[model samples]
Structures are given as C-alpha cells and as structure tokens.
Target: MESPFWDMMGMLGIYAPLALGAIGSILGCSAGGQAACGAMLDVESGYGRLVGLSALPSSQTIYGIVVMLSLNRTIEIESAPGLFAIGSLCGVALLFSGWFQGKCCASAIHATKSKPEIFGLSAAPAAIVEGFAVFAFIFALILAGSLPAATGGV
Candidate 1:
C-alpha cells in the first residue's frame, strides 16, 4: 500500500509547475525590470523596447499554468511517481530558464543603452533561453498525456 506522504507528493506535483514558474517569472521580471529602469535613466528614448524586453520572462508563468492544467487529475498512488517526477523536473527547467532569460534581457538592455544599434542582436540570447523553456513545456505536455487519468470522481 502507498503511504500518505506519496499521496501528498502527487498533490504537490500537480501544483508545483505553476508555483515554481510564477516564482521564477517574478524573479526574472524583477531583474530585467530593474535593469530597464536603470537603462531608462541612461537613455533618452526606446523605453518601450526596454519594457518589452523585461516582459519576456513572463512567458514562463503562462507555460507553467499550461503544464499545471495538463497535469491536473485525481491523484492516484500508482501514478504519483510519474506525476512528481515529470512535474517537478519540468518546473525546475522552467524556473531556471526564466531566471536566466531575465539575466540575458538585463545584459541586453544594458548593452543597448550604450549602443542602440545592437538592440536586436542583444535579444538573441534571451530568445535562445526562451526556446529551452518551450522545449520543457512541450515535453511536459507530452509526458502528462501518458499518465493515467482519474478513474472515478474525486
């Protein structure tokens, strides 16, 4: 028989993606937003671009929401391990991706502040980070499909 701890773990797993992703987004956005605010002081224009760049990390939260929804079902002991593994790992991937993407955005913002010509190029690194987040999101959805659905009413 399964322990109550494992059952709780399954429940935790269901929500982990959304929680972790939001935390990551919060951290990432703060980092980029702070840099953008500083950049605003240094630059005369292009405020819109800086603001837009800072918002890029927010996508991770949306991805997290999707993953959470995909993983949602009545938790069963038999499926608990899979749920915990896939959900937690995907959440970690999203968390790091969002954090790093924000750092990239900050660097890009700083660089562009001094040299406006590189604005487009500076966003490349952030985009690359975003690509990785997308990979995690896609795989989580795929794996979530393999888990057994709720067998009866919760």
Candidate 2:
C-alpha cells in the first residue's frame, strides 16, 4: 500500500503543474498590468505595444497546462514518485519563470514609455525568461515520456 505521505504527494503532483502555473500567471499578469496602467497614464501613442508587452508573462500558464496534460496519469503507488518529482519541479520552474518574465515585461513597458524607440530591446529580457520556461516545458515532457504507462493490471 502507498504510504499516506506518498498518496498526498501523488495528489499534489496531479495538480502542481496547473496550480503553480496559474499562481505565477496571476502574479506576473498583475505586475505587468500595473506597469501598463502606469504607462498608459504617461503615453498616448503606443497603447497596443504596451498592452502586448504586459501580456508576455501569460506564456507560463500555457506551458503549465501543457505539462499538466503530459504529466496526467492514474496515481498509483508505484507511479507516485515520478509524478511528484517531475510535476513539482516543472511547476516550480514555470512559476518562477513567469514571475521573472513579468518583471521583465514591466521593465520593458517603462523603458518603452520613456524612449518609444527601444521597444524590441526592452522585450528581450522577457523573451529570455520565456526561453527558460520553454526549457522547463521541454524537459518535463521528455521526462514524463520516459515513465512507464500506469497499467493497473493483474
């Protein structure tokens, strides 16, 4: 029988990816949105760009969803360890990536607001953070693929 701790871990693993991703998205979006609101108060011509930049942090949530889908499986005693390790690690990676990306987006918004010309350069940080999120997503998929299919057979 699975220990109570393993069972709890398995339960958390099932949801960690999606939950962490959503938390990060919420935090990141709020940060970027605040920056966008401030920038809108200061600028009039590039609202579109500002809004786009502010949304850069949302990618993490999508990545999280993908990981969650890939990690989905029946939580059995033998499957619990892999699920907990992979799901939680991926979740943490995506969570931090989104939050940092949002900070980058906020920075980009402010810089673009002041200069109006360095828009592309300003977005580079967020793009780099996105790269890290992508890395986590890819690795999680790769690892998840290696796990044996949970076949509760006789």
Best-performing candidate as measured by lDDT:
1
Model 2 poorest 10 in a row by lDDT: 145-154
The parts of candidate 1 lying over 4 Å away from their true place are 152-154
lDDT string for model 1 (45-99, tens) is 9999999999899999999999998888877888888889988988998899999
Please give each candidate's TM-score.
Answer: 0.95, 0.93
Which segments of model 2 are wrong by more than 4 Å? Answer: 152-154
Give per-residue CA lDDT, model 2, range 13-129, as digits (tens). 767888898788888888899999999999978898888888888888888888888877776788788889999988898889888888889989999999988999989989988
Count of backbone clashes, every candidate in sequence: 0, 0
lDDT on C-alpha atoms for all candidate structures? 0.90, 0.85
In model 1, what is the error at residue 143, expressed in angstroms? 0.5
